[model samples]
Target: MSTITHRLPQKRHLVTELPGPKSVALAERRQAAVPAGLGSGVPVYAVDGDGGVLVDVDGNSLIDLGSGIAVTTVGASNAAVADAVAAQAHHLIHTCFLVTPYEGYVAVAEKLNELTPGDHEKRTALFNSGAEAVENAVKVARVATGRDAVVAFDHAYHGRTNLTMALTAKSVPYKHNFGPFAPEVYRMPMSYPYRDPLGDDGVAAARRAITAIGTQIGADGVAAVIVEPIQGEGGFVVPAPGFLPTLAQWCRANGIVFVADEVQSGFCRTGDWFACEHEGVVPDIVTTAKGIAGGMPLAGVTGRAELMDAVHPGGLGGTYSGNPVACAAALAAIDQMETLDLCARARAIGEIATSSLTATAALLAADGREVIGDIRGRGGMIAVELVRPGTSEPAPDLAKAVAAGALARGLVILTCGTYGNVIRLLPPLVIDDALLREGLAILGEVLAESA
Candidate 1:
């Protein structure tokens, strides 16, 4: 049996400055070859990653707090993940599960069905990315309900694809100039407690949203009401405790499918197998992606069997839908999550990190400069919204400065929100407590300086 250890790998030497000579050289090459706007958020070059540390090509050993946008839940360059991928590659790379079904693919689906919330007989379909999973869920809902209208929430982010762009709420980068998008897609107000019309009353806000759906769109014409259980890109916004359950009840009563977009908040990222699980709400359809395959490109949509089977025999599949390598990696990732008790770790990390951020933000606020407006999220998926004093306005400049400051201190932090004023932390669930504390200390220092 392989021994399981909780210690993170030691950080090596940081010879040159951040994005040192080697990374600078690679960035230059990438700028010439890659598209102009392709690589902006993260540094261009990576030399190695193991456990919680990312070793850049410049030889800078930085604590990986971003986790590749929350995809590497089990940790970057995990031994089990590497071994599984290598062994599967040796055996068979791509058999195209659609053409010739493979055990690895079927096993992955079974695991997803078993793991995802909802005890009712569930069926799962695998896809290549979170975007594909969402697209498939939309397709299944449209076909199953025989309705054309799909309703998404404001400030929601589904994906970058054409159909998903219509579902997504952001327009500047995701939807700007990419329009002539899919039709019959509508947007509705989400129960944003921080900025809710009902003053943080989640239940009342949900009822208001439901009422709008009934009056404006007519629930009969709506195929599905899709939402992220805990908004990922909309700044780790966790809806009121009773908000999602109320919506799910409404969807069931009206026969409109409820799809939970768990792409960024699923697979133990939010302390449970799915964020929806926190509310005891079982969606008709759940889309999962990030953190599903230990960084491999794999996604899945699990839903009621009847809804999933609504598509005709040949309606739901892709050429590389369930690639064997990704399947094997997913199976191994699931094992790692279960064996390592990552869900509990996610909760623990969230408690520690969020508490630290909240305390630091309060201190800054007491100093007459409001540093954080809201600190909200469930489990490990947490965010701190930065704002100016005496108003709810976004502090984008401060957020940028804090992120850059953290990066300079050898820590990788990611910022997100509709206004880009929220500093989000998505460190791997397996991050050691010591490293986590160190990262939080760096963030506190940045906050103090920015204030």
Candidate 2:
């Protein structure tokens, strides 16, 4: 019922400028220690986080609208998760689930099996990151189907691993100079409602992709069709209604595994346990992370038992897979999510964000600014796609400025998309309504000023 935990004030307060003296010093230390490849969206250094605010090293409390990139949905300081992690660390941190199979790991698998879409008998394997989960999911599909080729959609972002890089559509930062990527990966069109070449017919979009896969990669040779139920890095594009269903149906009909990369859209962040539930389209495999362990490093691939079990026992585990402490955190996080009914909370957040963003878009349009070309997403995962003043051309610079402005005003936001023109809002599910409203209001003000 509270926004801030640890007795930290819930309200966003700026005691000093962002990246103040202490934070600037820490940034210098970070630059000396951390690799340049790892980029930080916000320059400030955080020392504490609770509820919806991140308290920086300089004592500036910034409202968290990004949820640590959607990984802290239960808030950054959930008592349940913190207690479980501490208790588990005291008992046993790691025996590598593969080496000494812990009950916590099994319990997490059970939870994922029950919560993910569909009633079919399911099994789950834990991994260390979303990229690992995706790689494992593809391994399961490939082994199950005995096919080598996989199909991914445009604007899709799977991961940074070589296989995932091949699966990803964007090349500049994600895939550039990372090749030669995994071979036999095919790219197909997604059912992007905003950029649909064939109007907004989900069925037609599916047909287009299906036909292309068959013609280009031969559907028979394709092992899986992997996609984000609602494209995440691809501008939070909520595909046209029926789009996922049609794709799922096609995959089933063609013996191709339909894998939903719910890494960013899962775990009640999308109003449901999984985004696939919105369209009632059950994926053959679902890869999840980022919020699965309440900010802990954990990921999972849950899917039908037949396909999951198809992988040879030794073929599936990593040294750190399902670290006992992370397993404990996941279990506790899951408990908190269900008890708090974060699904409904996400829905409520979605309503607020979408309404506010849509209203802002309307206002901008009325003023002929037209910076916000589209607003879409589900549950707590929402985004505003910025475009040029009068055209649909992406305005990535404007998006950057708006995020910078919000940051300067003690608000933390994240921007992502293939073209980098999307301002995504993924607040913690447990955030207080008042704080959430304040953050959104700041976003509106920033947009208005930027326009």
Off by over 4 Å in 2: 1-6
Provide the overall lDDT of each model, using Cα atoms, as 2-decimal numbers: 0.87, 0.91
Identify the candidate with maximal lDDT. Answer: 2
Best by TM-score: 2
CA lDDT, candidate 2, residue 354: 89
User: Per-residue lDDT for 37-140 in model 2, tens only?
Assistant: 89899999888888888999888999999999899999898888999999999999889776778799999999999999899999999999999999999999
Model 2 local distance difference test score? 0.91
Where's the lowest-lDDT run of ten residues in candidate 1?
1-10
Q: lDDT tens digits, residues 1-451, model 1?
A: 1235634465534567666777778888887899986747766377777767888867678888899989999878777888999999998998877789989988998999998887899889999999999999999999999998999999899999999999999887889998899999988888888877676677887888898888888999999999999998888888876889999999999999999999999989889989999879999999999899998999999999999999998889899988999998899999999998998889999899988988897788788877688998877788989888768999999999999888878888899898999999998888787788998998999989986
Candidate 2, 4: how far from true, in Å?
A: 9.3
